[model samples]
Target: MYTLHYDSPLGGILLAADEAGLTGLWFEGEKYFANILGPEQQERETPALQRTKRWLDVYFSGREPDFTPPLHPVGSPFRRAVWELLLQIPYGQTTTYGALAQQLAAKQGKTRMSAQAVGGAVGHNEISIIIPCHRVVGTSGSLTGYAGGIEKKVRLLQLEHVDMSRFFVPTKGTAI
Candidate 1:
C-alpha cells in the first residue's frame, strides 16, 4: 500500500492507494484516521495520488472538477450502495439521509430502509471528499453526522456554494 499527504484549505489530508485504485482519503486526525490500510505504509507520490491531489486542488479552488479520481472505497454491500448514491449528489447540491434510504429501499424492492443504517455507511466512508460523503444531510436539511467533523463538513459545503442558509448544525446526532 502507498500513502500521500496533502495540505488543503481545510487541513492536512491523507491519501492511500494500491494497484486496484485509490483506496482511502481521510482528514488528518479524523475520526477514522487511515483506517483503510494496515500498519505497514510507505509515503510516496504515486500516479493515482498525484491525480487525486490535482482533483483536490481544483475542487478547493471553488471550481467544479470535471474528473473524479479512481476510487475503491472498501465496505459492505449496503455501504457500497450508499456510497454510490453519494456520488450522484451534485457538487452544489445536498441530499437527506432519509431520501437516500428511500432510494435504496426502491432499489432493493423493500418496504423501507433505515436512515440510521444509511448514516452508519456514510460515516464509515473512508474516501471523504472524492466520494462526497459530506454532501449528505438530515431529513430536515440539518447538517448532521460527518465523521470528519461538522466544522469541516460546513466548510466543504460552503466551498461548493451549497446554499448553507438552508442547512444548520443540528442540535443532536453527531453534528460536532
Candidate 2:
C-alpha cells in the first residue's frame, strides 16, 4: 500500500492506495483515520494518489471536480452497496439515511429497511469525501454521523453550496 498526505483548507488529509486503485481518504484526526492501512504501508505517491490529489484540489476550490479517480474502497458487500449509492448523490445535494434505506430496500426487492442499519454502513465508510458520506443526513435533515466531525461536514456542504437553512446540527446524537 502507498500513502500520501494532503493539506486541505479544512485540515490535513491522508490518502491511500493499493495496486488495484485508490482505497482510502480520511481527514487527519478524524475517527478511524488510517484504520485500514497495514504496517507495510509506505508514504509514497503513486499515479492513483496523484489523481486523487488533483480531485481534492478541484473539490476544495469550491467547484465540482470534472473527473473521478479510480477508487477501490474495501468493505463488506452490504457496505459496498451503501457506498455505491452514496456515490450517486450529486455534488451539492443531500440525502437522508432513511431515504438511502428505502432505496436499498427497493434495490434488494424488500418492502422495508432500517435507517439505523444504513446509518451504520454509512458511518463505516472507508473513503470519505470521494464517496460522499458527508452528504448523508438524518431523516429530518439533521447533520450527523460524520466521522470527520460535524464542523467539517458543515464546511463541505457549504462548499458544495447546499442551503444551510434546511439543515441543523444535532446537539445530542451520534454526531456529538
Clashing pairs in 1: none
Model 2 Cα displacement at 152 (Å)? 0.1
Q: lDDT tens string, model 1, 1-176?
A: 89999999999999999867799999998898888789888998888898899999999999999998888778999999999999999998899989999999999999999999999999999999989989999888888888889999999999998888878887765937
lDDT of 2 by residue, 1-176 (tens): 99999999999999999988889999998888889999998999999999999999999999999899999999999999999999999999999999999999999999999999999999999889999999999888789999999999999999999998989898886755
The clash tally of candidate 1 reads 0
Looking at model 1, residue 134 earns an lDDT score of 95
Please give the clash total of every predicted structure, in order: 0, 0
Q: Cα deviation of 69 in candidate 1 (Å)?
A: 0.9
**What is the alpha-carbon RMSD of candidate 2 to the true structure?**
0.7
Top candidate (TM-score): 2
